[model samples]
Target: MQESDGPAPTSFPRPPNLLDGSRTSLRQILWALVFALTLPAVLIATAGFRSGYRAERETSDRRLQETARALSLSLDREIEKNEMVLRVLALSPAIAQGDFAAFHRQAREVGLASQSRIALIDMDGRVLLNTRTTYGAPLPDNWRESVLRKMQETHKAQLSDLHADPITGQALITIDLPVVIDAKVAYILSAAIGPEIFQRIIADQRVDRDWNAAVLDRSGRIVARSRSPAEFIGQLANPNIRDASAMSPEGNVQSVTLDGISVRAYFSKSPAYGWTFVVSVPVTELAASFQRSLFWLFILVGCILLGVLLAAILSRLIAKPVDRLVAAAQALGTGREVTGTTTRVLEFDTIQKALADAASDIRAQERHREEALARIAESEARLRLALHACHLGSWEYTPSTGAFEASSQCRAHFGQGPDGPFCYDDLIAGIHPEDRARQAEAVAQALDIRSGLEVEFRVVQPDHGERWIRISGRVRSGTDGDLSLVGVSQDITEQRLADERQGLLLHELNHRVKNTLATVQSVATMTRRAAEQGDEGAWDAFMGRVQGLAKTHDLLTATQWQGASLEDVLRSELDPYQDAMRQRIRLRGPRVNLQPGAVLALGLAIHELATNATKYGSLTLPEGRVSVMWAVALSLSPPVLIVEWVESGGPPVTPPRRQGFGTRLIQRGLAQQLGGEIKLDFQPEGIRCVITFPVKAVLAEPAPAEDSAERYAS
Candidate 1:
């Protein structure tokens, strides 16, 4: 081996300074760039603005005019919808048969959501049935003489202007349709809608806050308004509104509003009726665009100053990130790992990560080389360490010289101290007397055939105890041309124990399956006899029994037959009728686990009890309730689990005239399988069942210390 030499030093190239003193300042460059880009745009916009002033005025007015047109169309559709509803109500068969009471109920349902009401008025303007009031109750005289005259003249659905309700005195718009009986107008069916319905429509259209929107009838009266609708409704609109609408039906004009403010008004008249929708804005808004060019001239000078200020701020921000980047580069050159840092700049972050990754890759390569050499030159101590890690013992023998070598683990496998001397005599003495002779024969046979040796045997440890061991070996030639046997041994005592337990479990499973099949056969025979004697429910009863047994078996299988929860057994039988609200049936108990046999018996009994309750006990009545409670009686000589079921608020209970299959199963099966006592009482109030079983026989977890053999046995 050669001695180490000191590390050599090397120099790296330095980067040239990019920020030289002779270069232009970044602030001057930024100002030049901004000035060049914005100069032409500023000039062009300023010249165009003065020439386009008149056009802008027309556009503003036209936009308002279009908004008014759209609002007018929306208002027309709402009135049309109300008219259709009124016409449908007029055609109802109930009204034609003089059954106004029935018609009123139908109208109330249609208008329930809108707060609108329907009224039947005769030709004499007398209010008949009104949905707003109960049938046969006194109604206000709300008939309008003008509305009736107009309806009689048209004989079709028509919309009325704003009117006050006689009872509530609130403004309402009436949609009226006449009922024609035998070629004569007999009655008017009117649906009264509040003015707020139209006000909502204007607000929904997103009219400007500074603007005013209104709906006007043929007389130019305001029916609805966007701003201050309650105060303006039913008042006459601006005088110019009627004059301009009469001439063009839709146009923009200048007028003074009721508040004495000068406004530019735009109106659209509905083609169906003479109703007009008017949208108005202040006159000053139209003239505000004339000074926009002057505003831009001032902005142009401020942008030049802002450009210089921003450039200085940005340069300071970039300087710190540049310093960090330089430090990272120097660290990489010095063969030290580069520490990661964030500057929140994309280009700088990418370069810093690249330098860090290069440093990491170099370190990984050197570490891999060192580890590979170490594994190649591993010594005997390393081999012993590996053997101990895997819980295996190493052994070697030279048949030609009768030499034996063993690792510390091999000494410990025989209950000897790890540092104790172990030879051929010690190895032979450790094997059980019964297995020593057979193991010797196996080794001799393998040597004669020049093959491998594999054998399992029991070893008697002086201090530890007896344990199972398995060894395997193959013959090889040593450096001296002598035959050597090298092998490894592992203690498999736990594996052997598991195999014995599996065998006993198989035997127990076989016995249990046979008993279950016998139970199934007995139930089937009983069900078939009943069916042949004309019992319609015999098959259902048999299936229910089989399903109940399957539920218990599933519960046991989930726990590998260790035990089943008693609450789970009860739920399986009563889950169909279970109520989380605890209104009808209630189950209360302490946590108790039951053995497989007890689980099956208790589950079946609960199933029968629940079925009987559903058919003839508390479950048959809405108010009936059943309470099932259970607890462990630890004070008894042998602790016992007691369960009780009581029913109340049900019909009187009576004992059966003859014993049924379910009754017999609950009475006999629970006692036989659980070795418990059961009492079933059928009192006048309800049926009550009590069950008692030894806790030691049924509990899965609270058992005394048991021998290993007994635990594994059936």
Candidate 2:
């Protein structure tokens, strides 16, 4: 047994060729091939699954964010609407007058309309009126002291945190506003709405069956929940939700629910009320499809293992044909025509033919794509031309990149070069200095609300000229997931100028109407005084004077109130007398234009003189005659107008012992209105009168065509 320590007999192992012939070696080689293919296939499948899951998760998150944002916006609108109602009620005169009964009635009406409870409280939190109760009914001892205090301090509308209402014992929030009177806060107005309203909002915005939505107050208390509102109302939200809500005003988060369900959640805070809205979908639902994919992955792995065994068996027979087919497919993929490769295997030959057919189809598709691009370009060109013709310019601003794109007309409006890039700052710079801050604020508000922008502002050009522009736009998200504003701008300078002119014309018209009313009143009073003094003919004389004034107004109106010619005024007043006694009257004037005021005064004076001539001075007798004439004295520094009225060929003329209303009107009213002097001479032949006034107040050029047409018609 101590045998030879030197060496033991050694047996030689089989050579490589001998081992290759054995079943064990063949089995080992098959196993190695299966593992080599299976490992990479599994790795690729796993990577694909992971990537797909990540994409799905991100999509879900974005959808949840949108839903949350929508819900929050809806809540904010409701709250703002309620606040507006309170503000309107606060502005009521009854509220200012402390007419509690009347204010209560109105508040109750508004409450019924809005489906909410309205309450009026004093600074000390004492309820003065409550719509929830009968008129003059006693209110509960407890009031929303905190809300009242906040509204009083802020002097603006304030929304309260969630609390149990004293009347209904339901979770409610109050929107409070100060009732201001005499520039001081007199009382507080509150609109209390239950959480059930927000619950309805959540119901409307719910995404799907598996999704949950909840609205939370500033203190993290659940005010409303899409599911189990009765149970969750007034309760603190889950810790994770509270933390996430505290972190940001809007975002996505992954967390577990109180019931231990994983979820992807999104939340947004209301800008008006500081309430948070949450939308969540169960993570398990998202994972269900992923689980099914994993199941298929395992089955695929088994099939791959079986295919490895068959592949090893068929490897030698089809190797050359498959290699040629692969080479041909590679060439086709590289955009080269497959011409030379040939394969004897039926499957390989069929694959080669299919590859060649696919290449042809691809070339045809390429041609179609090029044609589509050309059409798109043509359409864009046409759109640009249309915008330019309309004097409208389109623009886009990407906030993330601070990039701005503008049409040619838009650049021109901003006084920018056509070739250069312009940004938000450039747009602001182009705005007039007076309007720059206001426009910036408008844009900021639009962006914050994600709403349309409509503003009219002035833009200063390089030459310092101002042009009014109206910019109207809407907020949208771009393809790259960035916020963008797209809008159109239009030149409105002509429109603004037209508006100003219209305003001036209205003002002038108002002034003229007031002056005419005063003159008519004075005439009526004077005539009434004369009639009271037993002059029965004064009424008829007054009517004739008013008619004279009306005739003068007609002349002025025809000329657009610019002025009236002295000749026209005289002719209009004396036309009736001239018709009655054609050869008895003579009128002469050198186109002397009279201001509207002067026209009224001088027309009345001529009417009085003609009346005297018809009644006694000259026209009483058929042979009697009268002459009226006017002339301008250019020798004076500002020039002067002189009008003479002479009557002749009548019975003996005598000065009246007592001045009548007509004589006084002719002397005093005419003098005061024309800012000049008047003389009345009673000569034996007839009555003679003279008027002298500065021509500058009653001088104008020839009327325009339109005015002349109106004058001829008058």
Candidate 3:
């Protein structure tokens, strides 16, 4: 056998056509019409049932809410009326004058008329008198200490939590009022009423027979119930009712009763006493109305079924001719010969001839489709090559399947093998650990908002180290109507690094120029002062100060102006003096670092001190000596820098007649510029100078800028 020049031809099973081997008889089409009509009938029935149920539920809920609100108002009015009775009794002169017998008789008369028990208690919570019993008959133990405390604290009348009377064991709620005598709580007058009073108020609201009404205290205890006041009073209310009551001052909830029957409950909370009034109606009542609507729907559907049966008989005659034409079309689609088949209907005959002509046209189009597919494949190859050359990668994500498809270049950029399957998790795994969360969050937010995604993150490639990559994409709909994320990722590592470097250089340059200008300004001012004094050597001294500044600048530049070593700064200024004096000069102490600003100030100060020692103080004689020492005071908060300059073994020192340019520079200019203190003492033996300033200002470094890449790029 000869070897093939191209890959061997492969055969694929043909996909099933939707219309192949499928036929719909005339009878089926007629039945389909009948069923289509039946669909609306069923929908109408469902809509009617839903409409009726919703209306009934809404009406019931509205009525229940109204009833609850009405009952609350009635209860508040009754309580207010009783409070008025207590208020009137409190103002009686007998109560304020401490005439217990007279106040008791007056309170007893008012309590009997209102059908409530009244009592007087002192501020210490001791019962002073009870209308039900004799005056001070071995007063009962204080049962409502919390209520009494509230009355005294608020200095107003308030309702108490539901409690049972100790003597009669009947459920009762109290209204406690603080009796104020000259701004002091002299006594508390309490009015205790039974739960029956609230039950009567609820009953008088004219609630419907199907509805049940209840009143609950702030503690969620059933103070009274219209249906069974004697049984449910003083008991904790239903949990669902308590929760619904707590959620809103007025609202409705669907809950099941204690008997397990579903009901709609509406509630309103009283603002005055913190009580909740509830009204419940059974769901079965609403369902009863819906059943009537459903019955009519069934009757209408039965009539439609009878009409469909008559149409089914007529469909057989029409189905034979169309069925023959359908078979011919199916056969023609499959490339089978449809030799002598015929239909009696004119429409069917016309369709058969048109399908035959279409079959011929389809054969010609198939050839063009194959050629287009070849061009598409070639274009994809060119795109891959272009992407690789530009250090760019292409990727697509299918949300429906959570599958990720990436080009070979994309896989390579992320340090994954080209043949390995790529997924969302795999892509995230290649991101730098510090940037992974931020990158993931950006993608998640884009997906949530259904918008375009643009993010930059670092990827740590196994072979190439870390690289910055920028990705940009947008959400689009595919041919099959599924959402897809398509985007390009470009390597930006080189650009980012270049920008960072440029920013660092710019910042250093700016800092150095500004500092140098400030130093020159100070030098010019001091030079002018010396010249004004008519010093013969002022020109030479000014030149020396400028030269000292230049030496310190060179040292700072070596470290990019981060800082200079204290030893380096001192040696730069003192090196010449030490060379001439040799063993007579001494330098000592721990090493330290000085910032750029401090270096300039200290350098000039050291030069001036060294010049003075050489001219008059220590270095004038062969036996004269100068010692320079510096140390960091680490014990202080933020630390401190201390330097001492001492000179000895020369002629006795005397104070200057008046301040010169050098003395003023050392005392004011150096101290102000360095944010430090300097002391110069003309001791008889020599000159001693001490300088101290915070180390943080001298040694502190500037923080690196965020987004330094942009600065460098600019």
Candidate 3 C-alpha lDDT tens digits along 68-180? 88677666656766665565566566877889998888787653334478889987778888887887688775677887778877667888778877878877888888886
lDDT of 3 at 47: 87
Clashing pairs in 1: none
- Model 3 scores what on Cα lDDT? 0.75
Clashes of each: 0, 0, 2
What is the lDDT, from 0 to 100, of the residue 287 in candidate 1?
65
Please give, for residues 4-49, the per-residue lDDT of candidate 2 as tens digits. Answer: 6777778665322211222432334546777787889988987887
CA lDDT, every model vs. true structure? 0.76, 0.76, 0.75
Candidate 1 lDDT by residue in tens digits, 315-396: 6676667677766665665543335555444445445654765767788889989888777668666877788788998889
Candidate 3 residue runs with Cα over 4 Å from true position: 1-52, 111-115, 134-138, 206-210, 295-714
lDDT of 1: 0.76
| Candidate 1: residue 643 Cα off by (Å) | 2.8
TM-score, per-candidate, Cα-based: 0.44, 0.39, 0.35
- Alpha carbon deviation, residue 683, candidate 2 (Å): 6.3
TM-score of 3: 0.35
Best by TM-score: 1
